[model samples]
Target: MNVAASGTALKRLRRSARLIVLAPGPRVLMFRYDIPGRDPFWVTAGGECEPGESFEQAARRELFEETGITAEPGEQIARTTPEFVTPEGEPVRADERYFIVRVDSPDIDTSRQTDLEQAWMNEHRWFALDELDDWHEALYPETLRSLIEEHTA
Candidate 1:
């Protein structure tokens, strides 16, 4: 394990593939993560890539695993630059790539979520593009509105 300057044990670098799922209303689906000791935040469907899995493969798998929806992950859209710690308390430098996926229905099934996901992800909501600005909870990537506008336009 690598040690950071702050004496924190750094886990291996991880590659994450995220999906921005959009429905007929042009709304985006977000999961509310209520991790311990942290305020709730909403994020897209995604997770770390399994061994030897490509970003696209991981995106597809995560989409199914998290939402129970099987759809092809569309084009790459955005990426996050910061190194963040996972909810499991592991410090990781994650190469997070975002993709777009358009679906006909906004319904989601969380029955396939892993134990860790079920524990922390307590709620989910589909937000209209215009409502995101007024949303009280934090949304990851900070640039979500612009990213959606760019893609929709």
Candidate 2:
């Protein structure tokens, strides 16, 4: 556990890798998480890195686990600075690295999601770049729209 300058105990740092999965429509795939006690929010497909795993390795593994899409996680494109609690109730300061993966098809397979994921992640969708701005739900990273626009430009 880390400590803040104010002498408060801070959430443990969790290293994570995320992917921006772009489909044929130049749309991005996102999962809607309905975590208990919190409003639903959309997020990319990714997860925490296992011990000794590189960000790239974790990104690939998470992509398969979350969407069943196997692809190379190319150059990192964005990152997030936030402190949030996981569904399991663990508070964490996430060091999240983002990468881009382009898929030929938008088909997703949730068969591989863990029990926790299945319970919280009830829906998935591919949104066009412009659709993100008008999206009613909150998007993690907050800067996702601008990030996508910057990269896809």
Candidate 3:
């Protein structure tokens, strides 16, 4: 086992950003990896804080690039981090901050997906808030889960 990384402190650069969608309704933008031999698992939309851009700007940029959806919601934002492992076995981490942006139109302009093997998500649907619990429990970070729970409660 690698012993040094365990004792090595993760000099966390707390990124102040946002997770775009929280509550369910019209359309919650999520992504799934189009692996060669497995079903897809949808995920929330978010990105890291840009050089000097605010979380909102990054969210909008990411949403458009990812789902081709342009959302302009009017709600307060939250910050947190979620854990993930890369397909290559390396660990991936992101300090995410999110806000609820109620979309203006129903038809999102998607097409930015470019990965030949990891692109082409089969489905995109708007689900109820209750539907989020399972995935959130499994995928979302503690801070994100707690924030969602408090809001739902």
Candidate 4:
């Protein structure tokens, strides 16, 4: 879990996939971090909002932790609620906010977390946003599929 502001009350937050690296192959690159104590097995790169900070700031921090890339937040994309099952077979919902940001960095540094190790996963398994098998399963709204589809296409 990455901190939003590097302070106390670094509380747990609902998650969203802050998408960067929108490329030409109808592809949207996402960095998925592995957070312990969860089912569906992974969490996207995002965190709780910071005090007096925009959502963009928290997005950037999460991006840095998961991928080591820094980006300026761009247009708001989608809202989704990713569904997951707890280890004990209970259902939980996480509200997710999706956004577009162009990242520029030598490498994505996964150095921000001491608690969880970051891992990269493909957003769409069969193809870029095509196969429904490997879904992002957002915690917010579900418009990102279309937003990213339009952005890439």
Best by TM-score: 2
- Which candidate achieves the best lDDT against the true structure? 2
lDDT of 4 by residue, 10-66 (tens): 333444445444544544454433334542332335654556656667677766665
**Alpha-carbon TM-score of each model against the true structure:** 0.91, 0.93, 0.61, 0.54
Query: Candidate 2 vs candidate 4: which has greater TM-score?
Result: 2
lDDT of 1 by residue, 11-38 (tens): 6788999888998788999999999898
- Comparing 2 and 3 on lDDT, the stronger one: 2
> Model 2, stretches more than 4 Å misplaced?
1-7
| Candidate 2 structure, TM-score to reference | 0.93
Clashes by residue pair, model 2: none
Candidate 3 pairs with clashing backbones = 17-97, 18-97, 18-98, 19-97, 19-98, 73-101, 73-102
Give the poorly placed runs of model 1, Cα more than 4 Å off. Answer: 4-11
Worst 10 residues of 2 by lDDT: 140-149
RMSD of each: 2.0, 1.5, 4.9, 8.4
Q: Which scores higher on TM-score, 3 or 4?
A: 3
Better of 1 and 3 by TM-score: 1
Please, what are the lDDT tens digits per residue for candidate 2 over residues 1-153? Answer: 677899999788899998899987789999999987898999999999999999999999999999999889998888786888888899888999999899998789999999999999999999888888878999876788788778988
